[model samples]
Target: MKRITTDELRAMAGREGLIIQGCGGDLTELVNGINDMLTQEGILQNGDAFKDVSVFEYDGCTNLLFSMENVDLNIGKLAMWRLQSHETFGGTWLSDYLPNRLGVDMDQPPAQKEKPDCALIGQDGNIFNLIGIASRTLKENGLGEQAKEMRERIIASGSYDKALCIIGEYVNITSAEDAQEQDCGFEMGQSY
Candidate 1:
């Protein structure tokens, strides 16, 4: 329930991370579409249309000031992807893609499953939910090798919950190459 200033956010990010502005999905595209529609209807000037009115993040979580006015504008999700990675292509989360590829419905209430975004993986501790979903998706989609490896790592940790949190917080395996390059290891107590 704590909020940090933009200065704190900047300090946390430094120069090594990216702050993606939108969900990069239909929700964000809908905002752009609405802006275009408003412009065409003469409600908004051509140059005054919303470019990227996205949700903002404070310390990698969605800053919840939700409203009809701000919903479509402000940074939706925030994460630190690896340097030199393409923002849109590389920053996509596994939960975001699992719905479409696996025909899993994500429209259910948050109580059913955590929303793909980390901000919603909230105080109740739903990181394990995310890891379970991702683990299933990986196995279902023929990434059994990776799934097996992930399972082994989680089991070896001797604390399933902590292992899940570690993966949820530190792992960034957005792609196969990312998994190869960013192997699941962390120096204990390291911020990144």
Candidate 2:
């Protein structure tokens, strides 16, 4: 999770916040190597480069904290990109950040499906019971996968309103009276 991001650099906005970690070795050697790298990259030369950057032992590891005021952020980014590849440089588990961990293609739109009816009003308001009704409705409509997804999201939703909303996402919520009305087309109040 250790990555020097472009946005982070901007947020710092020319302040003191860059740090480079050293793998177990001579701390002095690690510091010298970094200077050599910056010089090789044509970013900065040795001697004066380490003036603002401090090397010290921290939590059983040597860390180089760079005071960002003296260092150009763009040049620092270039240096960081190069440093990330070093076997004994940066910190543990450094890699590019990804927003969606589910591997789902966020670009594609969800398929349009006609939501089936589920009677929730005046029915058992218990969350589990409501979930059962919603799941059954979806399954009856031949949407077994959506039913499963709804179950997972509803249970982990962490609140009643959230769970109800999840059920509503997959099915049409109806009152008990409306369900009965849909079952029969005759007018309930009629005089002949």
Candidate 3:
């Protein structure tokens, strides 16, 4: 994936006819909190740089738009989200684009199967097994190709709603017991 800056992102939005100013899930809130924290810590003196910025986040992708004066503030916010525990499933968009804007070089992609950054974790701590919902989320986010891949995986997994699909992979349908017998260290958890 290519990395881009807020300025570059703005240009891309213009070229793609996308809305540059929008709301990303929790991105606005998190930016606000970080700005407030920075102000209190005496790291920022000219009010908050991100106060007037616009955000666009969805389906693990996040984008921001702010003035040059607050570039550092925006960079700080990106750092927090990109390098912190906020990226539970590695589904955040910070490292991919924002850091590149700040001249930061990120590591290369992993050699293993690249897991999808998004997942549906139920309130009961069970990862959702509903391929339909997953497919819909990807499709609605303009990731129609990813949605098709998800369906293919579901079909490959026998489309068993009760089957365990780890990291969104379509592989052997070995149960926890079977894994244990084979010493694969796999365990099944409750799903809601």
lDDT of 1 by residue, 54-93 (tens): 2445334443111122123222222222123335333333
TM for every model, in the order presented, reads 0.22, 0.40, 0.26
Report the error of model 1 at residue 43, Å. 69
Clashes of each: 7, 0, 1
Among all windows of 10 consecutive residues in model 2, the one with the lowest summed lDDT is 93-102
Which candidate should be chosen as best, given TM-score against the real structure? 2
- lDDT string for model 3 (1-192, tens) is 122344444232211111222334566565566567556655455574444344555334565543332234444544454355343424234334433434433443312323333434431323334555555545434344556666666557654553346324523222335535345444446333
> What TM-score should be assigned to candidate 2?
0.40
lDDT against the true structure, per candidate, is 0.40, 0.59, 0.42
| Superposition error at 50 for model 3 (Å) | 1.5
Cα miss at 121, model 3 (Å)? 56
RMSD, candidate 3, Å? 15.5
- Model 3: weakest 10-residue lDDT segment is 12-21
| Model 1, CA-based lDDT | 0.40
